[model samples]
Target: MKFYFFNAPAPASLEVFRQEYVSQNLKKLRLAAYLAMSVSCGIIMLPLVFPVLNQTRHATFYRGLNISLIFSSALALGFEHVLTKGTRKQPPYWVGQLLCLGFAFAFICSCLGITFIAQSNPKNTLTMYLLGLGTVAFLWDFDYLETLVLVALTSLAFTLVVQLSFLSPEQALLNHCMSFVILVCFYFLSRIMYSYRANHFLQLKEIEEKNLEIQKMSQAKSEILGVVAHDLRSPFNNIEMITSLLQKKNLTPEQEQQYLGLILTSCQTSRNTINELLYLAREEQLEAIPLERLDICELLQQVQQEWQSQLQGSKDLKLLHPPAPLYAQLNKDRFHRIMDNLLSNAVKFTPANGKILIRVREEKKKLQLEVTDEGIGIPERIRPLLFERFSKARRRGLQGEKSTGLGLSICRQLVEQHGGSIDVESEERKGTTFHITLPAVK
Candidate 1:
């Protein structure tokens, strides 16, 4: 199959997605509540218009009540539709609050007007008005103690109006008590639901803010690493070249050998440090390079040739590969770095006469590579964090080799960049195997 770079758009930021979800949910909930209120009110007030429930009623009062409720319900539906559009510019919070309050007040007024027009027994009329007002107030701002107090006062006023105007003593007292009780229960239930929804929205908002902060910090860190690495490379390159030149100059035979060895070792150490810094810099500045199909067998052979002298000196060194050629789409430079780090690690940690094996194979559309070594395997606790940058998993090699604790991290980054994964299986004093898997090109 042919490989191509597909530049998919970056996913939406967490904050944006979260905000949209919450807005949609709240809009749905409010719309449902408004619809229920409108339908229930309309059904309950039907008797006032039909004249079956009462005959001593004013036509103007009944007409006004019905018209107000119809308009309020229509306005509520319009607001809900506007909310559902998901436009960037939302109506102001105060405007929305006013709209909700206006609808609720109109609904309450309609219930009271209908009650007064239909009933001669003031007990029932006052009960209807108090219950409507209390419900509307609680729904408008359920968590406010002041609103609950207003509901209580309205209930008490209703009781007075019933007793003074038309209710029998016993009936007025009983209806008043029941209305107040109902108001209290509705207020508490509405308050609880409101609190829960508010807290849920707050928690989601906090998480979104944290995610944004983390993304910003990651970007800043990557940029800083890139800058520092770029600045360090030039001086180190000059130093390595100067050291090489000095090593080749004429000198006393005894002194020449000692000086040459010192210069070469210094250059090597500098070169290794430079390589580590470069890897880190690149990781910060770039996403994974797009993969290109190449022969892994050829790449490994070339790497082995580069490190031939070092591998030849170790009598126990063993390199193994499948007889058939293996091909993969990978970033070549990154792949080489990963392999070199693992091989060098094995050589350093393995004792004399201890074997090291580099093995490769294909398994079910995946390419697997394993580097096994009869070396002092990593400690159990240390293994988990082995691939973390600058992790404190330091150990002296058999030959006392120095390390910067960066190789494994670089290896991990490179493997992941190719849409692959790496893992280790090790037993102390037995062996360690670094296993890597990549998607195979069809």
Candidate 2:
């Protein structure tokens, strides 16, 4: 049963749309109320200019009805004003309904008063009622059912009043038929108004959702740029330092060769970083990485050798792992990124000649790895936020090395995405250790 008479929203969005619809219509409601007030005031002043009321025996009663109409309109306006004074949240649904129905009642009362005064001129009376019906149609928003109720009540009230009070039977019958026809015409008009308003709200809602999605994408772009800039800085700095060292005149052939090798390693690292950034930017959600069952101890040994070579004897890098190979399901590249970030942090903070240890073991179906460095330890206050992006805990290294603070955060994200967890332990000035736990392949 698909009835198009009511332009209703989907059920999931219905409640939200209702609130927004009411909020948006508040100004229109106020304007319609003002128009009702103006009409009432105009009719109230008519007795002063025209002597028609003086000829009527019920002048006092007619005067009273016009005054009551003005009062009701003002009351409705004041109530709406009070409700919408300082808030953006829409009032309850009944509140909007009450305002609409009240204003409709006021408009009908004004029509009745005018009809009574112009009864002697049947043509004028019919014209006044038709205009009133049209005004009700254009002034407010209501779905088909409410409009039907409004039209039915208005027509019946007009028919009963005309037949009982002023007109002869035949004249009243003619008036009744004409008013019903006018109301039926306006019923369709009211539906068009309702449909347009509802459709416009839906368009605006769609635009709003699109704007939110665009904002999220823009934010993601900024984050990727920040990450690329941060990670590339260290390797680029290493290349610059090694190149400067190689340029000095007092160096031995061995020293020059070592410095050139260091520069080459730094360049390779920078290229790897750029490749990783490209892969991340292309895959925003970091879709599943192809995993392999491999010996965890062998991977750690390879990383240890790489770092030992990069350190160039400045730090004593040692590995302590079980003699037997421990296996885990791992994404090789992502696992390398985690180790790189952790070791980079250790090397930066650890003073020259300090000891850095990589410990790996398997216990109770879990593989555990730890990197402990005798560096300037993390402050207690900083430990909690150490893994947060752009953390305030980031500080200069022992040799005044700069930090972007995003490394640890990236490490934690990579570890968690691989079904592993990372934690840190540190004390100011003594040492710091990072621990990682991953499921072991039995």
Candidate 3:
């Protein structure tokens, strides 16, 4: 009793979504055109079919009917050509309307053609087969109202032909029933087509979005490589220069040690840079590292002791936490690497007399860790890219220690492996605080 109509107009995003999928629609239209041509080819050769069947008596009438049907098929196929004339672009708003009308008109002629053949050969099963083919092709891309129109016009054409066809009343009744059957089959088949088009378009949209995302990531990767290449050139030059200095014929022991130390430092810096690049390049491997329950207090204690020995008690490094065994699911070695880089950065940036704070607590059923440094903090402009590879956040420590601009990025990657995230807060000349949050376990 009730029926819906043309798909409700979508949101602006879906309108844009539709624009992206013009190629798929155009391909469907081309295939439909070919299908129409196939039907027309058979109809155009109907005179030969009559002669082969030894029915030359009515071959003239069937030939004329087939000619009209062929013209209609040609016209319908011509409309489909509009989509293929040039490079694929967004289809016009009326493309669906025009295409459906074309198919509908062709279908009307096809039904009349079938009526004539069936009336001439009352027991011809070919009428049923042709009706099925024309209905499917006509309603392939039709909406509810459009489908209703197709069926009505086709039924009207079939009825008019039957009345003028001069077949017996019994034959007319049988063909009328067959018409009803074809219309019902077309109605449900068109509904299925509606679902098919929607899903097909949705898949294209997703693939397009993923391709765009991969393209953006590829561009970013290239930029990072360029920065890495530029960064590597200097330290490698330093190492080569220092290697040459070590080869002097005569040199003092202290002087020799100093040059050797410089070479070692250069090698270490280059190694760290390459390690960061490899980690970023192969992030998928990080997912395989399994996590285990880790004691937060013990880890922070180890970090403090390590830094205590490294900085030689020159700066105040404090570990702040509540007196509890705060446990969390974490990969210990990876987490240690995260803390190592953060503390190394804290020590490098904080002035000798400045303070560094490592705080851990439970917040919202998650473990929260913050590394606060009271030294040259990040500039507001650079803070956004602080964790990005080869970021503009690169800065010399208070002691003029070289920065690879890779430490925070490595820390973030390691944290993410444990199903957590890292963030930072800072103000120039005042201090910077880096926060790491992970899901806490009881």
Candidate 4:
């Protein structure tokens, strides 16, 4: 059997997919700020390590370092806002990459200059540069392998820088090793956090989709139940009426024949109504059979033949179509019910001498079948709920017959189940039209 995808859009582009990544980044912004605060605290304690804090030159050096930390923190806050805004209209990926690289370089230069002015020593510069490289690597969109490489390289670079700084190589090496261990821990912690947030967001989306599907299923079930209750009652009522009439005694041969005919017709109506209900129940229970290719034109013609006896006494019941055959991928039983419902409604509503036209045509990979009737059209107030279950509209015909009000609702459900749509247009006291559009078989 052939299958067709529903109306959902195709998979989104990478930029759109990156929007989810940005949401995860928002949570990290708070942690990043905390890290910045800790770094600022370290910068403030640097003066305690120096013996000449009372000197004007040393005091100015400490003040500059404090100012730089505050400036970096403020810039970091602005970057947090940019991430939160979540706008896709930002510059291309390459532009964002360049901008981030530029910021990293500027921050590295600032840290190096501060260190140089304070001690006039280039020995500890490599330690600061390694830390800067770690921060820069964190900001880049690096894969897992790249991140591991960056962490290892930064650790090695920091170890070398510290070893060259002091007279005692052993103490310097121990300190550098400790700092490298901390950097590695922070890197892994960030990676774990990112993974957790991504999984959580996906879980939330899946729950939402399931909830929506449940709601649709519940609604469809309710509609089917309501329609079945109403449609089933009508035939039972007719059976009661026919039995009541048959109880009369001393009837002529012609009267008996008429009563017998009425009984037969009522039984057939009852059977057809039950079949429609069964179809609706099956669909609601999620037992909808697969669709297959069927000749729609032949299907409609057969439906017309089934109702030929009823329409024979009426006037101007016409089937209009081109000679070419039209085929569609649909459930034959369900499509038959749809056509039967439409035709029955048309015949019941249209007056004697009024026209009922059935037309099937093809348009660009779709099959369009329409049934138009010159009948007492639907009222505007009732039209809104015309396809709703148990919604009885104003019924007027040549003999003023009533309706079960389930036919249109069943037709709509059947059409939708076949991956098609049905619509109605009517003008009160003028005419009514029902149009069904189905996907043409490939």
Predicted structure with the largest lDDT when compared to the true one: 2
Error of 4 at 260 (Å): 11
Q: Which 10 successive residues of model 2 have the least lDDT summed?
A: 1-10
Cα deviation of 194, candidate 2, in Å: 2.7
Residue-by-residue lDDT tens digits, candidate 4, 30-107? 455456557777767666887466464556765666567567656665765574455656434443433343344455
lDDT of 4: 0.64
**Candidate 1 — worst ten consecutive residues by lDDT sum?**
1-10
Worst 10-residue lDDT window for candidate 4 reads 1-10
What tens-digit string does per-residue lDDT give for candidate 3 at 186-283?
66666566556656666677799999989978976786778678877888899899888889978889999999898888788788778777776776
List where candidate 4 sits over 4 angstroms from the true fold: 1-195, 205-277, 380-384, 389-405
Collision pairs in model 2: none
lDDT score, candidate 2, position 328: 90
Q: How does residue 304 of candidate 2 score in lDDT?
A: 93
Residues 303-394 of candidate 2: C-alpha lDDT, one tens digit per residue: 99999899999999999999999999998887888899899899998889999999999889999999999988988887898987656788
Query: CA shift at 390, candidate 2, in angstroms?
Result: 6.7
Worst 10 residues of 3 by lDDT: 1-10
Query: Higher lDDT: candidate 1 or 4?
Result: 1
My TM-score estimates for the predictions, one after another, are 0.51, 0.60, 0.59, 0.59
lDDT of 4 at 310: 71
